[model samples]
Target: MASRKPQTPARKSWWRTGSAWKRIALWTLIAGVGVGLIAMVALLTAVYSTRSSLPSYDELKSSPNGQMVRVHAADSTVLVSLGPSYGEWIKYDQIPQVMKDAIIAVEDRRFESHWGVDPLGLARAVRTGIANRGTGRRLQGASTITQQVARTIFLSNKYDFGRKMREAVLALAMERKFSKDQILELYLNKVYFGGGAYGIDAASRKFFGHPASSLSLAEAAVIAGLVKAPSHYSPTADAEAAVSRASVVLGVMAETGKISQATAAATDPRTVKLAPEPRQNSVRYFTDWALPQLETLIDETEAPLEVWTTLDLGMQRAADEAIRKNAPGDAQGALVSLDRDGAVRAMVGGKDYVASIYNRATQAVRQPGSAFKLFVYLSALEAGHKVDDIVVDEPVTINGWSPRNNSGRNSGQITIRTAFTYSINTIAAKLGQEVGFGTVADMARRFGITTPINTQPAMVLGTSNVRLIDMTRAFASVGQKGVAVTPYGITRVTANGNVIYQHEVDTSHVLVAPYVAAQMTDLLQTAVATGTGRAAQIGRPVAGKTGTTSSNKDGWFIGFSSGLTTGVWMGRDDAKVVPGLQGGTAPARAFAAFMTKAVAKRPVEQFETQVTLPEWQLEPEDNAYYTAPDNGMFVDADGNPLSEERQPRSDDSEEGAQGDEQLDQDWIDRMTGNRPPAPQPDPGRAPPPRDAARQPPQDRAPPRENPEGF
Candidate 1:
């Protein structure tokens, strides 16, 4: 009886009632609507924030996606084609119909009909993403051709919600302003195809060795496939992968009715032929060095430009070959050659540019060693000291440092010219002290050494670091008759057939007096003629200095010849010492090799005659008083004379007397036009009393530690 009463009144569950279910459905609908409103507000906020930073439509329309820049050598040889390699702009109608079809078929099927943002394409992309989740398949992108144009022109390929919103907004704006054909043209021209190529024309040329206008269906399909993944589908990178992708592109084209299935089947992807990869030449180093100068010379414009450089291709090739042939196997070499007007004619940054792009000629800064002595002697001459002025080459202390010669022995008293020719460290140190280290540093700066110079006693021995280009420019000043020279590479820049920039030659700023330059030139000539830099002699009137750092970590030969100034440097990038590596060896020989070819066509020119100075005399009691030998003979530390047969022929000579006899004969021959017999001394006046000044100084302090002996 109780069960029957309960059954009669048993009510339906609340959730099962119609009113309860209706309430639940109503709340669910409200929640979904609120979320949609929130998303709409967030999207609007993102669009509003992105609109302000967008570039103007006019700017986008006027500017080409890729602009070409060409650099030409002095001989009009193309040195490099910078930016986009295609200098000619391709118009929309000029693009092949097959190319357009291939791109549209694979990239956006509804490109002709859909707006910038395709709703059907977006829904399909979302469905694809949902299906591809955790399936290890790439999700499809729904960006229409117009949207791609908008993104490529005004936005980066950053995958984020905000960027998408901005891209959508820009796409709508672009759709309103530009025709579909115009958008398609921009996308075709602006898209990158890897291998330093941009645009369809460049890609076609780079991959097929032909223009886009001549592309075949197979080629078009291949290029269209590259738009998805340039590096992966590049014919140059992977021929098989590129062909496979092209086959897929052809299938898509056939399915989309852009091409007949029979035509797609007849076209063989394997028939695609790729052009040979371009060889990377060492001349790229020079172009790389000169490229940055463009920004400084001209305004930032998207127009194609032609840069006429001062580079002499012949000389550049010679320099590259010289560096390759002369640089040590374990070391790298760099050479920079400049005309008297400071035009950079040839520059080799390293033995192989492909191995390393760090430009040693223009970028590397290393100790110049005795090559830096050019500045020191120039300073001495500027300070009222003549080339023939007496300077003690004996051991001396400066600021607790004693400087010694490369031979670890002193030549005692010697003329400034003779000391400089021999690169006597003690004499250089003494002169630095007398004239002031600050003065020496200032002289280097005046001569175009832009790097910071440390005003220290050791700096007199070339302990300061310097760039090869700067050092070459300094010596160029001397070759320019004391006029300051600023090294320049670009001669002129033109755009749209209009000259935009031209280099002006300025020789009004004088770094040193003409007489001082002449005197310094004489010293440098002596150095290359019979001293440490003798290895650099190219059977021409070349003048330069040899530099060998303390540990032989760096070797340098900077000189001028036949209206050309060149600097050669050899060393390891890590500054590791190279055994038997000296400035007079590899670097000097490289200079000779380079100059022999660099100046082959130039007329032989003579340097300005040296300025003669009054004969210097010293008091008999002065410890620095001494005389040079009549026969050009030099004595060793033990007072033993070196015989002609025993004298070193290379720069390893202890007293830098390798070619002294030859130099003496040359001077005599030049003066009289004939070699004369050596004048016999009057028994040398009792042998000049054994040169008492050569004796070890008993009144001086003990020798201090000498670093970086010259």
Candidate 2:
């Protein structure tokens, strides 16, 4: 064929006549066009593939929203609501006109004119995005109301080009299938507001504590403004931000002719009063205490649950008020009150549950101070030592560790009962050393103090950390006449009126002998009546101990009334020492105040008393350096009378004068078989005014336990 054409003067075809570069350029253009068409088809296919199956117009006639789970208190009173959906659903007709207008003004100005997909809005958004690229500013959104409704009903909250394309297609379909009012109704019912609220009605109730139809102009503006970003514009989370957003909404409504300029000016978001956060859950601490037990008793399920607990609302309020009234101003405090049977009646973990959720009563582990001495004393009684047994309160060292009395004044060779009453650390430490620290730790564990304990000698003075709940449990055991019980909060749990869990009456075991418990009660009563815990006296037979750490870092008062055992602790979270803080002061007063109110309806009963061995018969000549005569006077090893010389002395002495009077003894020579002689007293010092030499300045009370050379 080419040869025949050449014979006719070589008539060239279109491609053969052109230059090589021109032909190559033409082919490249044709190929580019073909590839572009293929890409267009592929893009269309991808967009169609990504489109989600949407609900028909008939399906959107009714709202299909989630329901919330409500939490009830012990008294069957609705305390709070907990679930993904909060508050109630609302109908489109019930929505306030001001709220809807504000939403349209700010979110979609051309909503009425668009067919679910607005080209003008899209162009404007694209231009804005281009202008803000790499500027760290949020990109402008171009989604119409119908598009938003489509996405909410049929798509996830993903933002991308493909998702946008799919949303556009769905929005177009929605416009053709449904009316504008129908789309708006679906959007209003499906949109998410913050605080677990899902719709306009829920958001109105959750934040403003009212129905959507009852919204004021300012409130309506605030609710509409939250649609942009629920968390960012939450009224409770950021009031200023919410108010600012509301102002912007009001301005938009004014500009869009939805409201007059005067109306917008008069509507102040600051004047819009939201509900006071549902009264702050008056018994929130009780709920927190019962939640763990509630979880443990029930199986995992999404169904709503109701729990009946042992919390006494009156007692809870009293305890909260007392702690807030008496706790150190700069420190936090916790209190746990239980019935005699170990049922939790009241709990106050901190001053404000909303501010902090840490359960200090059950979760915090702190040194119990002298409150731990109760264990040491109980161990001594268990080890065959009577309450009246004698223990020297003189300064002594063991394993290079020496502890002192809190008063810095040692009453030499005092009775055990007396030592316990005064909270003497030296005697407690000596008793702990004598009874074996291991024995004390075991005793604590047996009494329901499940917290870890150390066998160190210092543990006798309450150096081991323990929880307030455990201490309250141990004290309740004593009040229960030796029966140890596990503290519990939930009494019954019912789901849909069917009892799922009912606390089998807590079985109790004897942790202490009846006689020992009675004696301990007596000892603690004495401590409250005439000793360090005097502030805890409630005009009745009460028993307790006062605990103060070395640097005032912790102060505790654990005591029992006739029908309840309560523990209170006051301290700083960072363990900083509180000035002038003492267990016998704020903590004891708090205990008494709480008890007075908690027991207002109950009658007072006497604590069971126990009689121990007589003080005189408790001694059996167990030492060689000291002897207890019939008159409770001490005699030296050389048969010399030292009663007048061995008097209560200042705790600062190191082999110095025994008391205000200075006296020395002269013993006879053993080689010559001569008798020992008593020495004369110094006449220069006349008794040192009794407490003058022993007492510290009023402002400088002796350091707690007079820390042993630390």
Candidate 3:
């Protein structure tokens, strides 16, 4: 073969020829083009399949995401936003150029050059992600601004190859449908900037307390940096991280020629002023308590809602500060304040909401102790008992259980006013028996105490658990002049610009007769004025009661003044005793601290004057010496008997002994008909020399027997 025709120059094998190599390259290119065409066809087909499910462009323009539910205080202060909060949509012309430049530098420097997706960036991201796999490095994201717009408006946040293909397709389609500026405006308005804020406008106002048009270069950089990881770079959540990220943004801005290097270096990220955050997160407690009420007030809708609540932001701040300052280190405290009309003004569910979210003011059910005596005294007044009526505070047994005074020493004889003022448990127990436990429970229910009230003997001493809100509502009823109150938070709710709901006060329901309320007010006023609740006084008329459960596991002070009713409770969540804790101590002091500031702007209001009643007189034969069947003796020269035959005194003798001087004389006059004038000494005759027999009786020794209970 080698000898034949000199091998034809070995045929110059086509494989090694230059022209053959060029032909081979051409074929390789053609095959690669064919493969790319098939891939593009598959991608188009997949994108077309998802197109039908994508939201229409107009739909995306309407609302890219669900609207927020904004809760506002009574003064129009924005307290919280439940979802994505959006501000007024800003036009492209109104957007700050610096903001746009900063965002472009940090988010997408190639935004102007790319149609939608940056091919070079996509390739780099793929290579880096591949290299980073299994290297403990997070995979890089290659979403362009157009891609983010597509995702925010049309796609769910699911990570997969299918989503990526759909995103690319949508971005391409968006580029064809909208101009670059339109896409950027949409991006700036629809992107979430953390802190519940969405859009550049909301982010600007939220972080700088100004509109987007007012953003400075430094502030713009800070806001722009938030786009990558809103929560992680939130100026409020982490100021240092936010500033650091902002510095990176500034550097990139200079490098991209969007800003001068000198300008970038001159900008101080630390100097950017951020809006002041709430003093404490405890406002979340009020928001939590009010959110459920929102659900009940209106039908569910995706439309943005504005809930104007009755909360007083100033009072809320005061209440929060009071709780934090007064709540013992080892214990927690809660407070609920309401207007006389039953609108919630402020609520502190716990000293620290971050530590626990259980709303003790509305959720906890603990013994009210003497605080429950409010219903007992009100029931007595409704049953025709005078506040000045004498009732022996001696230990008394009811159904084999004896209830004693909180002092653990029985006061020999005191008016109902004195007994209530001192929080005498024995007197409360006696009144409970006299009025019938069923009547006491009914009275509690009538005054907005929704919690179940037991009719057992111990229940007379507040052994039953009750919520602070219910108790505050009950006291508000008294402050409302007997009108039954239902505590409400949201005063009005509006959606888009239409009023969806508005709270209406119903004063037609009466919890007690006006005169009965006046009588109860009189008793409560005395309690705070000079008795156990004295610590709750704020130099104005206050009517409240103090309660301390056995072992001091719970302490409470519930009071009302100047149309504001507040209840304070302190205790451990587990109901363990707090050493030295009592209603008269920290709880009452907290009440004073809160009410002092809460009522500072309000005019002083006096409780309704008590109605006059016939002087309570004891019948020597029927009431002077009554003995219980269980050997419990009660002796009172001026006590009224619990008998059907006993009748109001027909004669105005004014023969009953005078009450303590510490008692209000005007109140005593209202209870008793009128006191007779003292005998005048003869003008010329020396007053009879003071004699031991004529001297006032010495203070009676405290009863020897120590009571077994409060």
Candidate 4:
């Protein structure tokens, strides 16, 4: 009935009567518009949020990436790099034009015309992304140079809509503030070039062994092609892939009018030669020792830094070779050398840095063995003992501790110089008791021995562990005529030619008395010339001591010339005894090898010493008295005397002096020419003047008319 009533205009409610295709088209258009509005709203929200959260443009420009910290050798050559990036920051104009063109042609042809965001590139990227989505392929990226700079400076490397919006906004802002060249410069410097390099300069130097300013056209193309994926196209990693990428870059350069077709055709990627890989090797240990010092020298800065260190590449290499040649097989060792001013000239921390980075020269804590007797001897000298003072070398016991000589033979009665030359453990122990162990420990500390010391009788035997650096520094104090020195590596730190920090050496603090140092130097020189350290002679006047620990666990040779103070230690890292290793053996040989190369460029100079005590005479009454104990304790001058047996023996004080050469392999080697012969006396040389050793004791005047008392 209702249909009958509406029959006239049932006329078709526009829906049923209207064209079906038209109706469907209208709805489709409406739905598309609605979806577009939603997407537009979302994009607008993202842009606004990202813009609000972006860092200020000034902040971004100040430290776009991490600062580059370089470690330079003594000659101002780069030794190593320490930072998130390698190489240095360069200005836009410093960039080679060929490199710039290659980059522009391959990375972004419209780089000069875009406002940070290339519209055509974005469109092409969108089309490609949609087409690849169905094929499930990796989506391609279309980032302009400015966009890359923006991301490098401000945004993280996350793939998200929000981050991309922020990148675009920041890139637009960067375009507004910085010129295109400036943006390009920042991009080149901030981009990662693989192989742990960041920046065009680093990449250039890393791959070509030269600087970016020296890049050729073909080289520029090779580097330019690496920006897309540094490791993937690294010439060092894969030459074929790198050459293929470079060829593509050259073709693009031709197409973009950056290079002529003939030039592109003529260039061959195969002709490109990479540099030899650098061998940081042991030099890295020196740099590692130098890095922590920067914080104390300069305030932290966002700009790149150049730290000029005191490392001599030649000396370092020689030291490394010496260790390799002479060090006991499978045993670890270290070598440290310092100039007279305490500049660390060479430091080899270990046998191989690649195997272990632990810096034995600066960080290892081990017993100094008899090397520490130098300090004990110094204490005794300060306590009124002369180099000619006689001490009995016999078995002695102190607090249940009896010390024995390394060779199981005693000189009976030996002068302090002879005792030290032989490194007699018993005489050193008795001296420790005589001067007080606390005094010896304090003396060591004054000479820069920071390792903890136990003031026990065994302390004289070098039972206390010490660092090679400290030992070298202690010897350096003696070499510098008693002036204390803090061993330093970095001489100056600069940024853009402006000095951030310049080290000012302090040469005023005297750690030991000048007379004591001089006397010690004289005695040590005699030791090297005629004692256990004879193996260390390098055709020059060398003052040194040889130290061998119990059971040959550690061996040390610490010495000084007028030019350098060096210390060499050979031992097992695990503290296990190394068979057949002794201070007078491998360690002394290494010392000679190192000093030979170290002093090659230096003019020869002798030690300067002046005797301070002229009128002082060693009187018999001034000596203490000692007696042998029934416990078989021969409390002689070389042995620790009990409080009750501290009686002096005057009869055995004057003994026959032995020859300069001792009955040891070290001495035999020197005499038989098994090693390099000592410097020969020049023809018709002047008669040697009377030295302290030749001076007669003023108290021994013809037994003095004791004839009357008899």
Give TM-scores for every candidate, taking all chains together and pairing residue i with residue i: 0.61, 0.55, 0.56, 0.56
Q: Model 3: runs farther than 4 Å from truth?
A: 1-65, 85-280, 406-409, 610-699, 702-710
Off by over 4 Å in 2: 1-84, 87-278, 300-302, 407-409, 610-710
lDDT of 3: 0.75
Model 2, residue 193: distance off in Å is: 11
Q: Candidate 4, which segments miss by more than 4 Å at Cα?
A: 1-63, 86-279, 407-409, 609-710
Model 2 whole-model lDDT (C-alpha atoms): 0.71
Please, what are the lDDT tens digits per residue for candidate 2 over residues 352-397? Answer: 8766657789889988777888889999987887766667677867
Candidate 4, residues 1-710, lDDT tens digits: the string is 45554455445577777898989998999999999999878766655565676565446545646568888899988887766645777778888888889998998899999988899989898899988887865445678888888777766665788778778877776676678987888877778777667788898898898888888988888899998898689887688889999999999999999999999999998898899764549998898788877766776546789889999999999999999899889799899999988899999999888666678999999887778888999899878898888777778887778765432345465577766665666778799898898999999998999989888777787777799999999988988888987899999988988998888899999877888888898778766765557678887678888776654567788998756999999999998867656676788889999998899788767666421111111222311111100011122223243343232221221111122212333443443233443343343674234455434444442111000000
Candidate 2: give the clashing pairs: none
Model 1: per-residue lDDT, tens digit, 1-710? Answer: 45553457769976667697788898899999999999988866655555565566457645555458898999888978877554345788999999999999999999989767899999999999998899866546788888888776766665678878777887766666578988888888877777667788898988888889988999999999998898688787678889999999999999999999999999997888888776777778888888777766887456798999999988988899989998889999999999989899999998877556678998998888777778778888898998767667677876666554434456556577667665666777788888898999999999889899888677776766799999999999998879999889899988899999999999899889899999889888876765567678776677888877655677788899899999999999998876556777788889999899889888877777632211111112221211111111122322223354543223332223332233333442353223343443353353233345433344532221122222
Query: 485-592 in candidate 3: lDDT tens per residue?
Result: 889888999998999998999889987899898888888876665455656868777888887765566788899989999999999999886765667668888999
What does the lDDT read for residue 592 in candidate 4? 95
- True-structure Cα RMSD, model 2: 15.7
Error of 2 at 523 (Å): 0.9
**So what's the TM-score on candidate 3?**
0.56
lDDT of 1 at 91: 85
Q: What is the lDDT of residue 522 in candidate 1?
A: 86
lDDT of 2 at 629: 8
